[model samples]
Target chain A: MQQCYGSIIRRQRHFIRCLGGDRCNNSSSDTLLLLNDNTRMQSVMSRSNPAIEADALSILRSISPTLDSTKHKGQAGKIAVVGGCREYTGAPYFSAISALKIGADLSHVICTKDAAPVIKSYSPELIVHPLLEESYSVRDEDRQSVATVVLAEVDKWMERFDCLVIGPGLGRDPFLLDCVSDIMKHARRSNVPMVIDGDGLFLVTNRLDLVSGYPLAVLTPNVNEYKRLVQKVLNCEVNDQDGPEQLLSLASSIGGVTILRKGQSDNISDGKEVRSVSIFGSPRRCGGQGDILSGSVAVFLAWARKLVDKEGHTLNPTMLGCIAGSALMRKAASLAFEDKKRSTLTTDIIECLGRSLEDICPVG
Target chain B: MQQCYGSIIRRQRHFIRCLGGDRCNNSSSDTLLLLNDNTRMQSVMSRSNPAIEADALSILRSISPTLDSTKHKGQAGKIAVVGGCREYTGAPYFSAISALKIGADLSHVICTKDAAPVIKSYSPELIVHPLLEESYSVRDEDRQSVATVVLAEVDKWMERFDCLVIGPGLGRDPFLLDCVSDIMKHARRSNVPMVIDGDGLFLVTNRLDLVSGYPLAVLTPNVNEYKRLVQKVLNCEVNDQDGPEQLLSLASSIGGVTILRKGQSDNISDGKEVRSVSIFGSPRRCGGQGDILSGSVAVFLAWARKLVDKEGHTLNPTMLGCIAGSALMRKAASLAFEDKKRSTLTTDIIECLGRSLEDICPVG
Candidate 1:
């Protein structure tokens, strides 16, 4: 049964690769079949559908810069996560902290005044800004002024950021969401890469214009989020059997903005082509994992962009970023599940991150 | 039992040297043993005790670079720490700033706003950033937006770090812990070396997957931390009688990542072999001493790694790093103990870092 599943996945992968372009068309079924002797490739096919899985580990290694002593601080990457609120501090924390763990030299969080102390109390590791305001806290008369204050505070630090991870535990507040829309606009204007997830997806779904035609925007959506995106973009229900086709249309509809659909395996597209990350993952469907994926994708996207800028267009940095991020997340999740089993939490999967990357690409 | 320990150390050192090549076999083990003898091993097994510790001082002298005017800045080392929070700010400060006093040309600390000022106030030589946030300050409705703010702050300054020590004063607040976890993931993805200690140890313990297979990661754990790690990974209790075997098992279980178990004598293993560091440590076991160890470890880890990379791999950089760090910290503590006795404080020991290092490895 597993072998049969493997064959099906192998076939699908070939099909998708063919769609990818001439680069992948020449390496067809026979070549993949010949490579199947390697247990890693065989195992990839045996479990889940490998065709949708992108070559994430390789992308991760290839994109990872060599560690050198001469480099100054922050030369690797700098990231910001715009989330964390009263009821869901863990989400923003997960996003921001993941950026740091993955090699961003700096990580920051901008949240509400109430969330600041609590988030600050969580750890002195994060720079918590208490600039955001919600409807309940602001008087109706002060709404306009408070919005200005929020944007002004954020703008002071805008140009310094390499990328921003939006939506992790972002609750739905009309006023607060409005403030975020402005922030997103400012990020776009400044040319900072933005990775949208969670409530940010909700906001972007409702107002597609916020990220439309923005090449630096990357949306990481869960099953439900993808469904909403499909409905909004394609005006139709999600067709799982034609998952790649739908995703391609949705991304192209968004004007080439990247879309990473999260699942047992992550499927990513930048309108032109589709890539899947079918690496094994833990069965533990814990919460906050999505936040990790978003944060991770944000960092990789920024790194990829930087590489593209420096290398004068050698490869697709956005696709490479997605592949690396998805693979590392899945690999870590698998390792975490091995230890925690049914009891695994999002934290367990996070701890496995370093080891997972190391397994795929050993460091010296 | 003592002979068994020696054999284990010898075999492991041999393997480490083998990882480097034939030229390193003879001098590397003897020097490493000497350094180990003067640090962790000295305190654990008394000369009259059954287990004889190796000579650690020689190792320190061997690896410690001679001070020469011909050498340029940063040749000695460079180090960074990814930690600090509102609740605790001392960890990152101690870890990064300590590298400077121990002969590193540069040291940097990446922390949240609440902790950055406090940590910076603690020392002028260190570079501190106020980035990162927790949850309470943000409204439930604005988390996604806030997370973006946080990632942007850190993303602005990722990369320029040679090695990062995560989890110093890191608090366990869900929001902050989550962010720290992400930072670890990013570091691994970037292929940077990390030394895990304090709250960082806590993060890794719960999420072993983060550092599981990342060989560049070095985890330093105290007794309770070590106990929990053994229980979680090996699924057993701590065994004193079979310390070396158990340490080996623990390291191997984690897929070859280095583990430095802090006790009277520090035991280190990379799942290959167990080595002991017995050096000149004070009888006084004071609070905040671990901070010194962490900082020292960061410097030595960087230096050892530099040697490995530059000299074509003389030994397992991780192992050599542990040995050198354990020895230096012990020597400094012993030196401080002679002056302050029972009143010895962590700060006093920190003050002795330069002198102790100079005594062992003079730069003249």
Candidate 2:
């Protein structure tokens, strides 16, 4: 099954190479038309099935930066997870660690004071900051000052991070969410890409303005989260009969921000086109799996953006990131399940991440 | 001797597989009978000498969970060493790092403030908490509040740890011991298993009530510490003539808590059955071997407890933990001795833990 996927990915890579070569010689208008034509061809080929599955493996290969010895530590990528409170530590740890395991150079976690020691204990690889404040910990009189302090603390490291994973285990404490919303504004202002998941989805779903019109923002929502988002944005129930079209509309309604609707087949759309990643995955619906997906997307998104900015490719970086992250997560989960079966957990999938990436795109 | 031990472990694994398959159709009573019968047969076979040695290698294999990709970080084990004061740091580092080398996903050290930086400098892999306080640091008036604060700090993370190894380089400070006593009492209240060694043995020997009726407590005592425990508990001198019986009485007097007596044969008992791990060990009477033993016992104990809890096994997890810990420590020590000979330090023995475990239970 994997070999067949690999062959299809190889063909897609060949097509992309041809497109890149043609763009070098052709006019910008002609190149743009060629890109559209390529997308149309892929859509037609995939029309045999209702869901338009993405060439996720090819997108992953094309965007993954070739590891160079000359490159410095942070050159690979620096990802920060802005989640972790007294109630939730494992989610942030899973996300941050997943980023590092997926080849990010540095992974940081910005969490509340109560969660720092425990999350720090999870892995020494992560740089954990006990900066954020929850409602219970912050008094109403001191909320304004504390919010400023929290934003200032994150602002110092904002420019350095290639991307930020906004929520993994982020709890929905009103005061904490307010501070995170501020952080999101600063990140968006800095033009840094953000992957929102877990409670971040909750935050953005209720207050769409936090991510609306931010092309760099990626919202990854599971079934219930997507339902809530659809209700909030589209003002209607989720239409399973036309999930892709509705997802595309949902993205478009949110001002063209990318939305990756997580399910048996993860559907990603950027209001331009819909893509699905239906590769093999484990049946275990573990809690922290989404955190891993968010972290992976953050790293891949950063790499994809870097590729487009440097190589001048017209690919949708957010869409590419979602496709690659979903594919890799599913592949890793499948490998973990093969070994652990009924006992499969989030950490098992995490351990297989490096091997899975290597299987798809060897470091050599 | 190592080959002989490996064969015994292999045979035991085969037996366990057959028994596990039988468990699907067989009644619980039949399974219990088979378990007891197996234990009895092994005991009878090892009764050729004065000391009844356990099939340590087999016990280690049975308790050691297979390394599956589906397991998360802490699922293998999350151990904490509550030791390392200003005066002594290497012992706690040895204990905590030994746990990681033996396959625990995370290892933490709760030490005195002054010891934290030194321990942290030793290895970035360990999560070191500088929370404990000694007499000189705390004023007479602030002692109570300081103690309370220290206890609270540890209490917050008490539930997350799989097992706690109390006192590897824990100094003999009155104030620190008092704080640790409170921590131990809290751990007992929370039902978190503790392995007491080094200065922890001193604290427990003087104040037996802290772990009096706690079956989850495992006391790992060296020669002098064992002498003190025997004197404190049985109120008598050491008796080599009836070593196993004396060990049994000592453990029984402690209300069925497991005791791993460090010596040539490493006798273990829980007042129920006396099992000695007389596997081939190095002649090196090293200082930090007990710390390694404490750490290894904590991991194995956690694994054994998890297995029993999930699989409904009939064996005593604590006893199995002691046996497995003893066998692996011995095997690692022997391997380290073969390589370094006279220069085999505690670190050398620690470096051998992974290979030693792999030899007994291959990951493949």
Worst 10 residues of 1 chain A by lDDT: A65-74
True contacts kept of 2: 0.00
- Residue-by-residue lDDT tens digits, candidate 2, A1-364: 5464444344444433432333323344333432555553444244322344567888888899998789988988999999987656778988999999999999999999977877888778999999998997888999999999999999999999999999876888999999999999999999999999989999998889999999999999988889899888888999886677788889988999999988767888888677778776875554578889999999999998888444443448999888999999999999986775533557778999999999999988
Query: Cα deviation in Å at residue B319, candidate 2?
Result: 0.6
List per-prediction Cα lDDT, in the order shown. Answer: 0.74, 0.81
- Chain A alone, TM-score per model: 0.90, 0.86
Per-model TM against the reference: 0.54, 0.66
What TM-score, to 2 decimals, does candidate 2 have?
A: 0.66
Candidate 2 docks with a DockQ of: 0.03
Q: Which candidate should be chosen as best, given lDDT against the real structure?
A: 2
Please list the residue runs of candidate 1 whose C-alpha ends up more than 4 Å from where it truly belongs after superposition: A1-20, A26-52, A308-315, B1-364
